[model samples]
Every structure is written in C-alpha cells, then in structure tokens.
Target: MDYLLTCDCGRKHTVSRKQADQLIECSCGQSLRVPTLRGLAKLPPATEGADSPPGDTAASTISKNGENPWSGWRGPCMAAACGGLIVSLAFASWYLLQRVSIDTSYTTEMEIAEGNKIFDLYTPEDMSLVWHSFESLGIGAKEPPLFIRWNRYAEDRARRASIAGGIAAACGIAAAGIWLSSRRRV
Candidate 1:
C-alpha cells in the first residue's frame, strides 16, 4: 500500500509501503519529512526498470528528479535557435551597411587618383548609388568616404556587433544541444 504524503509545495506523492518506513523523501523537493497521507498521490510506477516494473504507468515528466530552472520553459529550450537567428541577422545587417561605405570609399579614391578607373562601388538601396555619384561630381566638397567618417565609433560598432554575433552563436549551440538530448533512459 502507498500512502499519499502531501508536501508544502502543494505537491503530493505516493509512498510505497517499502519506502514508508525508509524515511522516504517527498518528491516536492522540500527539505522536510512528514509521515502521513495528508496530500500525497500513488500514481503507479512509470519506469521500466525490471525490478521496479509495475507495468506502464503514465508518470508526469514535470515531477521527475531534476534541478533545471528551464525544465518546462519553451524559451530556454529554443534559446539556441533564437540566438543563431540573431547572430545571422546582426552580421548580415552590419555587413551590408559596412560594405556600402567601404565600396564608396575605394571607388572614390581610385577615381580621384586613377581618373575614372575605379572599383565597382555601388548599391541598389534607396538611391544610395545615385547620391554617391552625384556627390562625387561636386568640386572642393568631394571628401573621400574614409576621411569623412572613420573613427572609434565605427570600429566599436563592428566589434560590438561581432561580439553579439558570437554570443548568439554560442547560445544557439547550447540550446540545440540541450533540445536534442535523448529521452532514452540509461
């Protein structure tokens, strides 16, 4: 016979006769032991460990023995996926923006010294190409892209973006590994 022992965590568990006098600990995780069937449950055994085999009993995964904070949280379980997405997005965004400025600078420099013979520096976003071309045609006001805006802020932004991307990758990997953990028993 199993007596239901109610724990302070509003959780009740079943105590087998063998485990009764054995100073059975409550599954509620409380650090206290009380003898009684006040608020406990005796839902059959759910594992298939031959010795404790009691047929197939639907055991609650939530009540399993574990100390995971994100045990039942979907966010933590899928954190890796989210982190990977963020890293990819940030990298792509920053790359595109950086490329635009880089291309503009290289081309402008080549055109100034090489005269019309410069690298292909153009983009098809919101007339970025046209603006650059038009601005390049001006006299005395045609400042090279590098000398215009190249400083610590830009480098810092790039570094921070990379750091964020790296963090995201790490998070993604962690989440993936945990999410794919096998439920296959030992």
Candidate 2:
C-alpha cells in the first residue's frame, strides 16, 4: 500500500511504507529527529514562516525560466522578391518617361522644320492661291491650307515607337502598383 509522505515545506508525496525511512522534514520547517517509516509518515499541520509548498515554488521557477515562449521577429516583404519587382517596374516607368520626352522633342523639331519648308516652297502668287484654298477649306485667315504636305526626317516611325513604348510602360507601372497594394505578408 502507498503511505503518504509530507515535506516540512507542505509538499505531499506518496511512497511505500518500506521506503518512508529515507524521507525527512515537515511543513513546520523542522527536520525529522529520526528518518524512519514512522517518523516521516505523518506530520502536524503548518506552523509559521515555512516556505511555500514545493509545488508553488516549482511552478514559479518554471514560468520564470520559460519567459515568453511566443516572442519572435518577423521579416519585411520590402526586403524580398516583391521589392525587386517594384524596383524593376520603377525603372520601366523611367525608361518610358525618357522616351516620351524624346518623342515630344522630335515632334516639335519636325513641325518647326516643316513650317520653314512650307514658307520656302511659296512665292507671292502661290501664296494668294494657297490662302484662297485655305478659305475654301474653311480654315481661318491665319491658318495654312489643310491639304499642304511638308516632310521632315525627324518625325518618323521611330518617334511613333517611342510614344507606344511610353504608353506600354505606364500600363506596366499601374500593374505593379496594384500588385504591391493587394499583396500581404510584407
């Protein structure tokens, strides 16, 4: 049969009576005068100033040692693959902006050159005819004839390509912004 053993610290443990001889101490913070099956088995109730029961001390120690088990650090998405994608899209937008500027410059240069050519191609007599044609075409007095054709090399297919690329780059940047905003775990 199991015999109950009690420590002076008010901890209760069970052991066979044959093994009780090894046990000592009581809840009153007093050591046993004799460690025997009879000496350790039963003790009087708590006196004063004994340490809290061994179990309470053990629990406190365990909690203190454990600290916060959930504490951990999280990483940022800005440092990962999505961050590189954002940079790539930003570069694409810059590339498109440069193209747009080039296209505007080239278009302006071509129009200026064509205006000069149109002036050079006229004579006093031809100017009267052209102005009359402009009126017939419903163009204002200050405007040239709509049918007039002037050519300049700068306003070519390459300039059109630049405008197209700029539009496409703008779409790409929009797509990147959507993706970044929609994503989580950053």
Local distance difference test scores for all models: 0.48, 0.46
Task: Estimate, for each residue in 1-186, the C-alpha lDDT of model 1 and write its tens digit.
Answer: 444444576555544544433343444445434343432243443233212212112222222343233455644557657767676767757854774454224344554666433323333553676667678875466655553355434565577667766666777776666555523211
What is the per-residue lDDT of model 2 for residues 16-37, given as tens digits with 9 covering 90 to 100? 4444445344557665332465
Residue pairs in collision within model 1: 4-40, 5-40, 80-172
The numbered model that scores best in lDDT is 1
- The positional error of residue 17 in candidate 1, measured at the CA in angstroms, is 44
RMSD of each: 14.9, 21.4
